[model samples]
Target: MTNVSPSGPASERSTGRRVIRILIAVLVVLALVVVCFLVWAKAVMQGERPAALEAWTDDRVSIESFDDSVVMTPIDAASDRGLVFIPGAKVDPYAYLAKLVDAVAETGTTVVITKPTLNLAFFDTRPLDTFTRHAPDVDEWFVGGHSLGGVKACMMAADEEVAGLVFFGSYCSNDVSDSDLAVLSISGSDDGLSTPDKIEGAAHLLPADATFVEIEGANHASFGDYGVQPGDGVATASDDEVRDEITDALVAFWGGSGE
Candidate 1:
């Protein structure tokens, strides 16, 4: 009875209050982080709608827009071969329509362009089937992307269903050297972000037979019709030229035609 002074109860109350304060502070910080991320994602480079409109209206390919993706199918015929293309981070999916139209029209290949989460491919955790399902007629599928999207595509290349891997201004982070999956790495010669040296350095990650193509005078943003990108080199190749080279490379990789 050495004058406890009823301090035990008071101390317990103070400890509980301190815990509540810490929890509230944590919640506030989390909320702020979420808010800032959303803001940053929203402030993305918009695609050229006028250029994209041409692809949407092209009679060679039928275009269908979905909540999570856009499907482009050849009107004349549908090939068993398909391509699932992902756009660069924060780049509009429509921006890539014009570039990929030739793949569908000329090759009769079904093309599915994914709309990544938060406008970034890294945030999207969906499986390969998520976009492929849009083209139920396609059996043989190739996975590809531009910039950051290509990096994500590399991750999906491990799926057994994927017939091949294609990279545009990007390279794989993981090792696929032991895998037999066919890989086509197409890079822009003038790319500032994903420089030729970087692609060459990561070449060992791909299979020994992986094909590498460098588009002359092309830059990081040449893969799509997106106006411009920060920290990207100046592109000397016209949009049409870049698209033509891409179509040629794809056709060659697929052995002349989609069949």
Candidate 2:
């Protein structure tokens, strides 16, 4: 029999195995670092939580969490109008409960607030489709969002499941100027981010019949319970005052224009 030796090839194989293990260990460490960084980044993005969300607590309102969304329904039988809301980029979806609860209670509309991926709606644009599947009982469905979230909502409104669109301090980058979908655009007078000038300038992107309303003393961050956002103008209206008008605007829109 030929003499058998294990050293040469065995040593090379062992070296390759060690290299593979070292690479895997390095990858694991990098993954952990990335995870920790994302957590920290999201936490840092949070702003002062507004009192409006707490103040609107009503027993008539029922709250539930669905896949990455918060559904606020009236405890009593509500109007068949349904709304899917997208929060502003990096803002907590819960920040809107105060601002939206009164609207839901006052208008008898069922509202679902979709929490976007990493708080950015553009990353996942099918929120209307997702909300529709969850709200089969709604006779009519509308999609709305704040800031970047609204932009994505408008993008998704092309779906047949959506009957209307609402933009809270947001604009449509898509050319829906020809669509017959009812559009209600609410903006803040003092909003530096989605300023009045910018909104008016982009009016052509929307249908000619779109309803545009501006809250007298409101600002960009006034649309949600998150306090002053970076690069936002100083709000001249109290949070409650701003929210009240916003609720009224929504009620009128959903009942009149969006019907």
Candidate 3:
């Protein structure tokens, strides 16, 4: 009979089992930590309660009676250039992009934010008509929006009324015939809602001279100020950082020529 050491096979098996258990335990602890951080961040940074978001309400920006289609919030600013922000469908203007108005205004442009009256799939251009009516006196103009609102910016620029266009997370439908307007399309590589393919398609629709910039890690919702739940979408650095990039690009684009 062959003599076998008692510690050989048994010791190896025991060590393997212990190593597996330790790995499992470490994984569980890491998952819990992630869950805890997400909860804390959402509660402090992105509270869902109506009251938490209500604190941002502005009586000065509120226009009680304008054209039925459009609502504008005029910001205090230092430049003659006008910046209009039209929001996407089913979204409250104050909820997402409101945190960004002051940031855009800091670059020496007046902000005119539009809150849509109707809710649904179909987009209405009537709201823009109301804005055109109000800003007849401004010398220089710039239009921009979040998501579908970016399409509206393109539409406004195409009309030859505005000097430039800024699109945030918007797609260009195949029917882009307006090349006279200057275009700036900004999107993120990780944004699931608007893929890189869609952004490239939109770029093709623009004139060859149009400007395009892509943020490496941003998602659709990240372009706006509101912090989304962790798993719901891609997490970007911060709204302030993204908005700064946009404003600097816009200011530089306009600085060269009146257009």
Among these predictions, the greatest TM-score belongs to 1
Candidate 1: residue 141 Cα off by (Å): 0.6
Alpha carbon deviation, residue 224, candidate 1 (Å) = 0.8
lDDT of 3: 0.60
The 10-residue segment of model 2 with minimum total lDDT is 44-53
lDDT of 3 at 140: 74
Which candidate should be chosen as best, given lDDT against the real structure?
1
Question: TM per model?
Answer: 0.92, 0.80, 0.62
Better of 1 and 3 by lDDT: 1
How many backbone clashes does every candidate have?
Answer: 0, 1, 0
Measured with C-alpha atoms, the lDDT of residue 108 in candidate 3 is 46
Residue range 37-144, candidate 1, lDDT tens digits: 999997667789987999988988999999999999988866788989988899989899998888777777888999999999999999988898898888899998
What candidate 3 gets wrong by more than 4 Å, as runs, is: 1-77, 96-99, 174-178, 227-232, 255-259
Candidate 3 global TM-score: 0.62
Off by over 4 Å in 1: 1-6, 256-259
Question: In candidate 1, what residue range of length 10 has the lowest lDDT sum?
Answer: 250-259
